[model samples]
Target: MLYWWSKFVLLGPLLRLLCRPTIEGVDRIPESGGAILASNHLAVVDSFFLPLLVPRRITFLAKREYFTEPGAIGWAKKQFFTGVGQVPVDRSGGSAAQAAMSTAVRLLREEKLLGIYPEGTRSPDGRLYKGKTGVARMALEAEVPVIPVAMIGTDKVNPIGSRMWRPHHVHIKVGEPLDFSRYEGMAGDRFIERSMTDEIMYSLMELSGQTYVDLYAASVKEKAAAAEREAARSDARDAARVPGTRAG
Candidate 1:
């Protein structure tokens, strides 16, 4: 109820008018039954635009922090996320990851559309990154089809680190569902999971036309951060070597 209200009544109209969003292969989406919409993460608005354009309600599993912040503004954010069909899950990994998987499987079994970013996080440089195997595990465990979705032009509309969205056209490309029924009941097999995940990532790569990077996005971001820190340290050392420079 709230989801529809937010979509049609509040945010959806404004987004539609500004971005003039377009979607291809939307008919590929199942009219009923559970299925996984595996998408390439581009920008924060990727979540907003995909669901806004899709006919059925798409529920995403977001990190718990979005719902746990303190104060009235936090409460408002929590309400907004909830109304937009996002469910908060612990993303800290280990047991928390297993719990999230369980929640996702449960949702799928209930015949709901579940949106997942197989890369685990947004791409740092707009290239498609290797997908995490959790998406494979969920599809196999829930016995659902995985549909590769590509969100285009969303980064332009809402680029990384931007507080406001620009009026840019957005497009969504939906690919044919990849059936992993061949690997049914083999959810925990690492080798099978890797193969399935790779296949899904390949579909995303083809659909989005983005360069496919075999490395994980999170790892690349970590390496870049480490490099930046090292450079900063080197700069500090060079500054200290200057004769009149004072150490703070």
Candidate 2:
């Protein structure tokens, strides 16, 4: 099939040769059955590299945009992502989030390994951020264990705004599966969801050795962009106040 061909015949072999990723504690991943691989998102390649290295096929709930890009490059990207089993998720409306949760639970029921980034977005500053409780809810509903995975050096391999990938050696560390069976049938409890998500984040913090921020990564990125825009506006105002300076 396309997945095997891409893994063994096409992209997977090339990436392994190029990046030379190092993996640790891969045995922690369950040999069979449904489970959640909860990882810290670092770079865009974090999704690509983990699936390439792990023995089991991973299906990440990726954004719909990745699959909807236009032109030849977009077509190729769509092929690669689909070939590797990444599912498209729409994150626009309130119903979208609920729909994604439903999709994840269905995948688990079908006994597929699902990959989720509890933080909801890539770390803007290399520090782990507070996780969205959706992951905890899915785990509770699915009755599956959550395995914590830390991807190191991927940020360097393909850092923000870099089109070219460098041959940096990446490391993957897998921790034991976290069991939340004690909270079974408590899916709608906000307090239990928060406690479970916090515990999972703590495990990732220990595994990745990144500073833990209590704020969400997406919020941090937004604030940073807003600050940058404000600074630019302030500079423009200062320039306009200067005598003989044009606002162009």
Candidate 3:
């Protein structure tokens, strides 16, 4: 009820009016039963616009920090995310990841639409990154079809570092569902999981028309951050040097 209220009454209407969002092949989404909507992570608004346009409620596994932060702002965030039908899961690796996977499989068993970003993080440069195999494991474990969804122009509407969303046309393209029934009961096999994950990323690359990078998005982000830090350190060293004096 809260999801619908927030979508139709509170946020959905405003988003629709401003962005004038469009979707292609929306009919590809199953009318019933569980299925995974595997999407390319372009921007934060990818979550909002996709659910706003899709008829069924799509639940995403958000980071636990979004719900557990302290202070009044955190409380509001928790309420808003909860109202919008997001489930919080610990993203920390190891046991936490397995627990989150279990939660996702449980949701699928309940016949709910689960939205997953296979890249595990938003694209750092708008290029599709190699997908994490967790998505493959979930689909095989849940025995659900994976539908590739491409969120176009969402980055423009809610670009990185922007506090407010700007007016821009947003489009969602839904591709045919990829069936991995061939790999049924082989969820934990690393080789099979890699193949399945690669296939999903290929579909996303085709749908979104974004350059596909074989490396993980998280790794790319870490490298970029390292480079920035090195640059900053270099600048600091230069500043500390005596003016008009050559270094020994």
Candidate 4:
């Protein structure tokens, strides 16, 4: 209810005016049916933008943090998410992620469009990382077609740490529906599962124009964090060398 209300009532007019998204193959998305809208996670705004752009009421798996925020901000965040028809998914990995996948399958069975990010998280360095097999497993088990939608230039509008939105245009490209009919009932095999996931990622790579990374997002994030710390320490040391600057 809230999803439609917000999309058509609240912010629809302004969002449309600001972002005149040029869509290609909009007809590719079925008018009414169950399928997976798998896309590369590029920005936090991807959730809002993609859902709004698509004609269907696409359901995205949102992070648990949005539901766990504090104070008035928390209340508003909850309302906004609920309005957009987002499902709460704990992204911490392990058991929580597994449970989320299970719920996703249930939604698929109901013949609804389920949006998932095969790459797990937003590309840290604007590069498409390896996709997790979870997406493949879901599609095979649910027997649904996967549509690879790529969102580019959104990271610039709302990058990782920047708290302001820049007046830059964002582009979204929707690829043809990728059929996995040959792999029907093959989710049980780990090898086939990985291969299917890779095929989806390759389509997304062409759509989003992001460099492909062989490593996982979590590992790369850890290394990036460590590098930032080292750089910070080096900067502090250099500052201390100046006259009158406090030093250890």
Candidate 5:
């Protein structure tokens, strides 16, 4: 009830008017069955805008932090997310990741449309990154088609570190459903999963027209942070050598 109310009465109408999102091939989504919406993560807004535009309800596997936020504001956020049917997932590796995959498969098997970010994290830059194999595993386990979606211009509407949303034209392109039924029983095979994941990422790249990076987004972010820290340390050392500055 809350999901429908928010979609039609509250946030949905407001977001459409403000963002003016353009979605093409929305019909590509299965109207009455389970399927996976494999999308490239650009901005945090990607999740909100995608759900607002799609007629069918989209259940995204959100990080646990979103559901566990502290304080009154956090409580509101938790309620909002829960009302929208988003599931909390622990992205940490090993058993946690496996549990998430199982949860997604269960949703699909129960005839629900599940939104998944193949890249596993938001893009540090505008470029698309290598996809994680979890999405592939879910699709195969659920025996559902994977629909590639590209969300364009969401970053401009709500860039990282921005508190307020600005007017920006947003477009969502839905690609044809990708079938991996041939690899149905091979979900346990890493090679098969990797192949399937790469294929989905390629489709997103083609749709979004962003440069593709072979490395995972998480690894790239870590490297970038390390570089920044090293540069800051070097600058500090240089400053300490100056005659007027105190050395540490």
Candidate 6:
């Protein structure tokens, strides 16, 4: 399979020799069964790292673009994702948010390990954001355990838009499974979903130690973008005033 082949034969070996992800509490992950590995996304490589460490095959909900491509490269990519057990999720504009959830639910129903980033996206500054309630809903609906995975130092290994990866010691701390059997048969209840989501976020917050933003990362990115525009304008003015430089 492209997934495990690419990971074990390619990325896994390279990362092991390079980034050298240090794992902790790995025993927390259930050796078998369909449970949700709810983790805080830190870097692009976060997905790559976690799978390598976990012995069992884990699947993730990735953007649909990853699956929709053309030609040999595209085909290989599709094969890779499929081999690794990733599903195509449409998280772009003009799509309903629930669309992503629907696909994920189907995966859970199959009794597979559904790896979800509770923060929805990778943390811009490696700080954990408010987890979307979808993880909770899936756990409650599927009657499965929610495993919290706290990833540290991955952002430094591969930054948000970095073209290269640095050799850094990363940590993947797998937390004990959070039992939600008490909420069995209460999946459709809105109040139960919210409460359970909050509980999962709390555990993630403790594990990540990133300032928990009550708002989603998308909102935070918007604010950050606005700030960057303002800073860019200021820098442009400063660069224009350099001596002997023409303002063409």
List per-candidate RMSD values in Å.
1.1, 1.3, 2.2, 2.3, 1.5, 3.0
lDDT of 3 at 172: 94
Which wins on lDDT, candidate 5 or candidate 6?
5
- What's the TM for model 1? 0.97
- Clash pairs, candidate 6, are 3-84
The residue-by-residue lDDT of candidate 4 on 11-122, one tens digit each, is 6765566665555666888888789999898788787778778899888878889888999999898888889878888878799978888888888888899988888888
Model 6, which residues run further than 4 Å from truth? 93-96, 229-248
Winning model by lDDT: 1
Candidate 6 structure quality by residue, lDDT tens digits, 192-247: 88888888888988987878878899789999999999898878788789986643
Q: Model 5: per-residue lDDT, tens digit, 79-180? A: 888767689989788999888888899999999999999988899988999999988889888899999999999999988889999898999999999999
Better of 1 and 5 by TM-score: 1
Give per-residue CA lDDT, model 2, range 136-218, as digits (tens): 99999999999999999999988888899889899999998999999988999999999999999999999999999999899
User: How high is each candidate's TM-score?
Assistant: 0.97, 0.96, 0.96, 0.90, 0.95, 0.87
- Deviation in Å, model 1, residue 92 alpha carbon: 0.9
lDDT of each: 0.95, 0.92, 0.93, 0.85, 0.91, 0.84
lDDT of 3 by residue, 16-104 (tens): 99999999999999999999999999999898888899999999999999999899999989988887779999989999999999999
Error of 6 at 5 (Å): 1.2
**How big is the positional error of residue 225 in model 6, measured in Å on the Cα after superposition?**
1.8
Lowest-scoring 10 consecutive residues by lDDT in candidate 3?
Answer: 239-248
Kindly give the stretch of ten consecutive residues in candidate 6 with the minimal lDDT sum: 92-101
Candidate 1 all-Cα RMSD: 1.1
Regions of candidate 3 where Cα sits further than 4 Å from its true position:
243-248
Q: Itemize residue pairs with steric clashes in candidate 4.
A: none
How are the candidates ranked when ordered by lDDT, highest leading? 1, 3, 2, 5, 4, 6
